[model samples]
Target: MLSGVSHTLRGLLDDLQAAANLRPGQMVVVGASSSEVQGQRIGTATSLAVGEAIVDTVLAWATELGLTVAFQCCEHLNRALVVSRSTAVARNLEEVSAVPVPGAGGAVAATAYFRLEDACLVRAVQADAGIDIGDTFIGMHLKPVVVPVRGRTRELGAAHVTMARTRPPLIGGARAVYDVETARQRLQGV
Candidate 1:
């Protein structure tokens, strides 16, 4: 049987997908602290099992949608992220040298690092959407224009989950008429 946290995470993923309306090539960054999920201090307790479960669920969903998933490292590593090599190339993110481990990168990031296919540590990323679990501070990785996503489920396990999705910046503030049709057309397949 899956754990309660695992079930909660799956629901969170579904909510994110629906609310974010992410396109196939878009990205979602996740910053999770397993210790907090277990109701402990951020890095005081690391659970490989919880980390692996969350990573697996996110990867499955992202792969199904043809989307990228980035895992943010703990503050010990300056919050660099683990992203696929392709993501680094496509997003023009700087690759950093580091293999995330439990102590340095927290359980979620370390597990993601080891399990991700063709993964690399990147200096930063501007993701289309994000989830910050246990106040891990994922906002730094999201795009400039962010809209908060409030779902029926606000907490995942013992951690407080905050979600956000991004939109393209609106320009020509006053006199310009926003082209709603064009924007809808752009996201027609999402």
Candidate 2:
């Protein structure tokens, strides 16, 4: 089970990195259902062991890559997110008062909350990328102009996985220019 979770996470990262060029200080939000990972309906059979495996792996990988990681709570908690205090401060996110538990907040969020250094609950975040495991629905936390990435690892344990990475939204109608080189030239007073 542990190995499966780790492999799935690695696969998700590979797909995300391929699509989004993540850099230092970027944020990645994840929403997971341990029950679904165990082949049960979401919120019905949450498992701390599975949650710990996923959370630990995510935190370690994100930290090593110099990225911020956020874990989204289940509908039981109104889909609030668990993030590091530094992340909240840096991103100007509103911090809420709540401690996640296995049953109430869901095991994945609980494990991430307990494992994160200086963890805090936030109402929302515009994450650069996200992973939704077991249909937990993490779309609301992503930045606008989300580009979905079809990854090689589609499932983790017994759960289905979905991944996304965001980019700047394309603006302007016809006759409106949106070229990076042109923008750079304008910025230089060309």
Q: Model 1 shows how many backbone clashes?
A: 0
What is the C-alpha local distance difference test score of each model? Answer: 0.88, 0.89
| lDDT tens per residue, model 1, 36-142 | 88788889999888898889988988889998999999999999999989889988899999989998998888899888878899989999999888999999899
Model 2: CA > 4 A from native: 176-190
Q: TM-score for each prediction?
A: 0.91, 0.91
Q: After superposition, how far is residue 85 of candidate 2 from its true place, in Å?
A: 1.0
TM-score of 1: 0.91
lDDT of 2 by residue, 1-190 (tens): 7887887787787787778889988999899999999999999998999999899888778877899998999887889999989889988999988999988789999998888889999999999998899999999999998989888878888899999999888778765568879878878999
Best by lDDT: 2
Error of 1 at 54 (Å): 0.8
Error of 1 at 29 (Å): 0.4
